[model samples]
Target chain A: MANNHAGLPSPTLGDLVLPKLYSLFGIANKDSLYGAVAEFEDGPQLVAAGAKVKEAGYTKLDALSPFPVHGIDDAIGVPRSILGFIVICIAFCGTFAAFLLMWYTGAYSGPQIPGCELVGLCSYPLVIGGKPLFHWVFGLPIMFELSILFAAFASVIGMFALNGLPRMHHPTFNYSGIHRATDDRFMLVVEASDPKFKAEETLELLRSLGAVHAELVEDK
Target chain B: MAGHHHDHAVDSYQLDPGKWSTGRNVLAFIALLSWALLGFGYFNDHERFFQSYLVAFCMGTFIILGATFFVYVQYLTGSAWSVPIRRILENIMVSIPIGALLFIPIAFAGVDDLYKWAKPEAISDALIQAKKAFLNVGGFRLRAGILFALWSIWAFAIWTSSTKQDKTKSIEQMKTSSRWAAPGLLVVCLTGCLAAFEWIMSLDPHWYSTIFGLYCMAGGCVAMWATVTLISLGFRSNGVLANTITVEHYHDLGKWMFALSVFWTYLAASQYLLIWYASIPEETIYYKERMHGSWAWVSVLLPIGRFVVPFALLVGRSAKRNLKVLRIAAIWILFMEFVDMYWMIMPNFHEYAHGFHLHWLDLAALGGVFSVYGLVFWSRFKSNSLVVEGDMRFEQGLHFHQV
Candidate 1:
């Protein structure tokens, strides 16, 4: 029988301990100060804090949780997503592209074939099975497929572009405990750049709204 | 209240039959009078009467079938959002038996006049001779009878089981209903397709499209959704189910109606496009007949009225959420549904004519068929609980909202 710990490292007290050096990354400077972070145990408390901060006229605030909290977007006064409109416009382009492709290849002339004497491309009005040169019905399937293809592409690209995702670093990551945002905890970050943000006042407000811990986090 | 096994307040949502007695009586009277007028017209001019009767019969049967489809879908999807208004659907479905009864007149007298393939002399043609096995009067009647029987049985089974669950509150009953719905839906689809074939498609026996069944089903679902929206609005206005079936539910129903309109358009457009592209003489004849006459205007208007206008009006989220907008859209859709049925059936009658013909019999037949169907629906609706109050999911449905 194989041992359970065959390929594993043994647990040690050193692995469980927090770093003791307070200034290991050097003293925080003006450029590296990110914002204040507030942690809440659940969604409602985070939403409550976000609403209060929004009401106090803080514009640069975001709420994060392991899952989406219904009504929180409106509570935080986030603008409606415009990704749908972008996808629709791109989908129309897709339809147009499909139409043009079908027309040039089948109905209209394209680049000349090497052995053919036709000036522009494949012979125009080359009838197949007595079908018309450019029947819309013949083009509809391509048009439909391309439209869906373009829309899906636009949806993914537009979502990432609008969200400013794939960012290697964010201000929220300055807080050591912020990794909990992807787990059990809810977090709200009030950016230092927001005009209404007052470090002391914002921290106090978060605490009053049931934040388990509030602290000013410095960016690296 | 939390520990209470049952809530008595739920009973308040049940319909008060006495409340709408006067209205019911009036509808009943109008129905009787319309039937009398139709009978007289049928005897006076049998040919014209049959033409118009086919249109009305198609509309009524499709409406009932649409309701049956909705009920099965709700069970199949395990949707709680429709629980509050499910009873209204059941009531609408109960009209199927009445629809079958209405078909008796057409079965006995109108078949020969309405169906071109019903004539033995016409079968001498190669196309008719080839199709004689399926298009013959005997086969048509048998298929129609089977379709109606299947529809009635499934509709009754679903409705009875649902109402029974309201009293028992048995999760097992819910399971059983879901079990029945799987097979029930298959039967509905099959019979619905055959019904469309026997009732409408065979009117122009030479023309055929495999997509016709889906096109009819889409139209039926749209019509049913519109009717449901209108009735729900009426109930809200009259202070019945006002709390249980809220604006949220209406919004959901409006979305369904909007989606079905698009579906109906897709199917109709696909069928037309395929036939036009092929340009085969057999298939092209259908559009040729429809396009050359004043029916051409109707042919153009079908897409605009049925698809374009409704799509534009209902595309906005606020339009679906607003009661007044939803009501207008619903009424518009219902009118378009009538136009759709009219377009399908009326062209066969005026194939040789250059212009549209408006006959008094058309109105009489519409009024006759709808009034009787409405009477049956109203009676069934009045006798049932306006809301399924005992449904375990009813409270959840009442609070359902779009996030």
Candidate 2:
């Protein structure tokens, strides 16, 4: 499907000349290059480019915009996040732990008081405020709070874990003009590792999709 | 981006009702058979008939009322994501009058059998006398009449104004509907509270929970979402609105169902925990009666079936987006909703019985009420666009995708 670049010529000798020269000189070899970075004026153009690349079956692609672009995830076919499920599971564990802890500390009495009857084996039941030993009502507030606490903890930690964030460096930073990605420009990166990525054809596709500036950035 | 060029013209998007005629006829036949069974139950076991009828009536009423609230809130929030399914909600609301009509049997014939306060002899008791002002048959019927009248008026106004905008395409109509919806919501909440108290909660006149109305409303919302999801899926499978109502919308609907199920559980637990902790006789009697026999199993099952199972299944994003998983969740929630209503109403009759008893009349009444309600909704839906094709935000909804 990537080869079906209609109304466009197949890559010729001129398209491969620059990479061949870079490899021969060893200044910035093809293997050391990151990918093609295309900068657009705004969100719409970036989303369009992302969609175009996705339709062309380019798997290793990323889009960065100053603000969140709606529908860009679908255009790029991003998988749904599993962070919510993880947080919920953590919250449930928190709730269970809180309930058990409350029961042990508040409900489970030590075998110190004489004539303290055990309801079950190892059960020294304490009647606090004339309530049952394991009253769920009294434990509800603690359960709720602990659930929220764990969910908040999981949300932050899980986000970091899933995103593989806190990175100090990336190959994309090797591009001199890529700093605009965090500012007013929307940038799309079609990685060289993608099966469909031919440096010349990918750059041509990006430019045809209205990228204001498209260029290849070296990895090192 | 490529599929964004879909025809925005309203005419091309209208659903063909002819394809649904055979299904509607089959439903009509089943509904007629159920009504016949109800007639048989009425003659054979008047008390059980009334009990079953109350459950069915309240279930149908709440779905319609809940759908009305759903539509009002959508308008109030100016939600774009729901525009594709707004017509389905409106069509559900259009069944309110039919539900009101179905209430006629319960109002006149089943009153004495259903309500303890309806018996004149009960007036001799001091507590019953104290509640006479609100619980008498005259007052009960009058309150029900006013509530249904308000619901019918709001349903008509909202439904007509929305469908009218299909042709007029006027922003004023949208504004008018929003203006009406704001106050209509309050009326719904108020009437819903009072009606729930009169119809279901008052069965055990000595017991009262302030959150009973909210509990019913939460369950109603869940049921409403289930109904909408079921119908939308059916339509999609039949190639109606196949393109317009995509998995994105189903995922949202699934989220609503999951959220409301959680809310319902919260309210149910709050009500139970507060009563259990207080240990007040009046309050605890409700639970005491429910916990007596087979009813105890139901009390336990309510949390598990209604909240825990649905919550566990639907908490995942993929579960909501998967068609088969969603269908199972939707159907499960709907059945749990019926069990909820049954648990509330049927136990009042079996207060002294040792175990749970399933009466054939329960199915008969549910079938009768739902089928009749379904028929009304089908006709109303056929008369309107399956999607809100003419709404200004319709295009936005068609292209909506969750980020």
Candidate 3:
């Protein structure tokens, strides 16, 4: 289901001339190159291509497949996620916040003396089962619960944030064979920002490496 | 994970029986020496001997039962990752009969000394007297007999079927285990919980927590994971199954140890929180006895040592992968399980009012029971292939990797 423009007529004068005029006037063009896209038949083929491109000094590489490719992270040099560290920090804050809330309402909000006309307090006081006004032994359950709750929320939100989710589009979508990435094929992209990017050479390299299809994608 | 070879063809699943002959003899000698010491304790300090024996008995018995439960779980879940190590656990599970044999001392001799409900003076207490039918010695013996019989039958059934599959190489054996696993799990859970109530909980006839059985099971399961890890590590160090049971398997075992430790804390907190909030005298009495005097240190140590230390130590992925860290943690967890059992059973002794005291017989009995049980386990373990080669997913287990 690739977008085949082969049957269409060749580009008119504006297609080739407007981009030069646009560049002369410092105006951006939709035809700006985003990346070179390659399609491979399977995960191993894509992983091999990833390793070769990385070895060739292409740092801005990405891959898309219907399933996770096990060694692709190492091949593509993806760093380990720091979401665990983020979640733990949030959990500690939650645990402290829970204890603070309990201490404020259970003990600090009220006067230490037996009787005092305390006013403008957020909470009066609470004493249950002859326990201390704010003993941690009694407060541990709530503290543990809040820590877990905050950690859960942080993981979900942190993962989405770290992944830059909720977006409508990505540069990889500009490839004509992109849709097949989610179905049968594996897609590898070498971004135009990479220092090693030479459109024709990269495309030739991917083709030589056994890509089923290779093409340069535009920003639009 | 580096510098380790994964040449599965080179790995030998056969354990040379003669290789462990020294270990067996040492264990047997220790068992003989400790049994003689325990015999002296039994004749001299009758009550203390039963108390110490019960603690050691529950320690070994619960772990064996937990192994049985674990084996059934692997079958029920159809877990391929545990296939290589399932035989080690099955060997432990099959030693339930030895555990039953060890209980003969407590069942026939120590019942009168151990259980207050078995004593005539317990009938004077209205609350305990009200439960005479189930709490009596006759009923306790009958229930103990049934519990042992059921556990032995199920353990042998699973072990025999799985071992027989080694030669048959049949998928029907897997189906058979999966079929029985459902009912087997139910039977083990019910009977195991009942055994916990009869053996340990009955030590305090007046005080009861519905969560005690689960607490016991959770501790035993953690100890079982630690035991399995230690045994696996032992085999590796002995140059047996060094390649077959790899770091991946050890990592999984470490995860079980950590998860079960947390689960144990959950059950322990559930039991404590309710009684603490309600302030019921009978329920609170159990904690009160342990939480005061010198016992308070142990009560505090239980959570810190068993839950907090292990949780922090093992929570990291790297720590579980590190063999040295995992080894220390397993041994620590095993020690904590014993401390937990000691905390549960020791406070019921008459000397408890005086404060915490570790009797010499406690060591003698522990060494005695564990050594004898170790011999039983070695025999069963050596009789079969160290790994389950017949398992349909054995290769999957061998190649198991966490992404």
> Which candidate do you rate higher for TM-score, 1 or 3?
3
TM-score of model 3 (CA atoms):
0.89
Q: Ranking by DockQ, best first?
A: 2, 1, 3
Give lDDT for model 3. 0.86
Each candidate structure's TM-score, on Cα atoms with residue i matched to residue i, is 0.87, 0.86, 0.89
lDDT at B308, model 3: 93
lDDT digits (tens) for residues B323-389 of candidate 3: 9999999999999999999999988877775477889999999999999889988887566788778
TM-score (0 to 1) of chain B for each candidate? 0.95, 0.96, 0.97
Name the weakest run of 10 consecutive residues (lDDT summed) in model 2 chain B: B3-12
Candidate 3, position B14, lDDT: 73
Each candidate's fnat, listed in order, reads: 0.38, 0.23, 0.08
Interface RMSD of 3: 7.1
Better of 1 and 3 by DockQ: 1
DockQ of each: 0.20, 0.20, 0.13
In angstroms, the error of model 1 at A15 is 41
- Pick the winner on lDDT between candidates 2 and 3: 3
Model 1 CA deviation exceeding 4 Å by range = A1-33, A52-59, A109-125, B1-12, B350-353
CAPRI grade, predicted model 3: incorrect
The lDDT per prediction is 0.80, 0.84, 0.86
After best superposition, candidate 3 residue A181: deviation in angstroms?
0.9
In candidate 3, which residue pairs clash? none
